[model samples]
Target: MNRRMMMLALLAWACTAAPAVSAASPPVDDAATAQALAQAETRGREMFEHDLAAERATDALLKKRMRGDSRVRGWITEPKDNRYEVSMIGEGAVVLYRATTDARGILAGATEALAVPAAPTAYQAGAAAARTLAMQSRIDACAKRYNSVVLPAPGATTDAWTVYLLPATTDPAAVPLGGSYRFDIAEGRITSQRAFTRSCIQLKRAPRNAAMIVTHMLDPTPTEVHVFWSLWARSPLYVTTGEDVIWKIEDGRIHRVQD
Candidate 1:
């Protein structure tokens, strides 16, 4: 069957499933609710694992087909409800496809792969950044590099607030990937981070003057606020400026900035 058919089937099945009673029932006390949550988590894990495996398989297949093609790096997989988005990279082209899987972990519904322009350098940089940011040990490095701006709110005393700033490549030549990022710090130790891509940017045809805008909270002291701006560059041809702000504290957080 085609991927569209498989997706339709999955949608139909999900629709037919019986809905649970008591929409507000807590999972801890409700058996059915607990089971549903567990199942969802399990499915998420399984989907990620399967995606990894599929990427490896696709990589090997591409290597064989290309015959020692150094430009052919690998594949990345994104899983959906009943289908997967797979992108295979090569020297000058990329093959993108939507693949459906069967219960036995076999590829079932398959679509004709679409060839698109490739951006090897940009892809490598993005993949590297992703891997590095995903590691636990890198949290501190990331935090230190992109620390939160703390400032006081106007007309408020004894109340200070801090907001985290996300790290990004400031390279003008690099493609811009939109996302909101936050870091969790406890007792001076970085705990976790919440990061996601809001939209994907095309690297192959990225504009020459591409730039990213990042904003963070300032200190909660009316005296003075220090703003730090850091940028990473893929080339040495770009120029940028850092903006400064002064603010006051209100309600335990920075409320206003002196414009």
Candidate 2:
């Protein structure tokens, strides 16, 4: 009774306890997980903002050039060593790549143009893959706070996404302003960001720039394309009044045209 019963009892306990011991998890490193997430968020936001600034700077150059004979047909971007190479194409075989700062530095002087292969597909692929990073807690925090939408940036081929923020208020009399950030998907960092309060205020006050886009614009176009949004604003005198704002894109550069 004693020896056999004891052995049987020990065997039963071992079988039941072995499974539980094997399934037990090691101590969770909450700190490490949190830190990794934070870093990802930081990188995502940083890249997005950086790309936005670079696009703006390029737009300035394009609008100026467009006024002349150098009508840009299309363009793309390539990320070099800590820099961005923007290749603007004119008519046929009229390609020129200019290396510029990574959206952080000032767009002061122009770098000499270099011959580079056109690679829009590569950039787009990178952007598509990196988009999953948007779910990271840190990047999500920024999006929630800014009321932003994340998508591929219009114009250029820098493998980046745009985080566009909506205006605080849509009142015509008060003003309509917003902000946007450009993120480099491959690097998972913000390239640049800019606030457009003044432009919004001006557009809001003006009856001409009344019609605005209620819903944000997602895909502008396949190639160099432009988007429009009907600006809607309210005034004490009138109900809802406004005009439309044209977001023009040429070779990855965005410029606003308002009536």
Best by lDDT: 2
lDDT of 2 by residue, 178-249 (tens): 333233343566555444222222234323312222212332211111111111222101111112322322
Task: State the lDDT of candidate 1 residue by residue for 190-209, as single tens digits.
Answer: 45554433332212211333
Cα deviation of 104 in candidate 1 (Å)?
4.2
Q: TM-scores of the models, in the given order?
A: 0.28, 0.30
Candidate 2, poorest ten consecutive residues by summed lDDT: 221-230
True-structure RMSD for candidate 1: 24.0
* Candidate 2 Cα outliers beyond 4 Å, as residue runs: 1-29, 63-78, 88-99, 103-105, 111-259
Report clashes for each candidate as comma-separated counts.
14, 37
Scored by TM-score, the top model is: 2
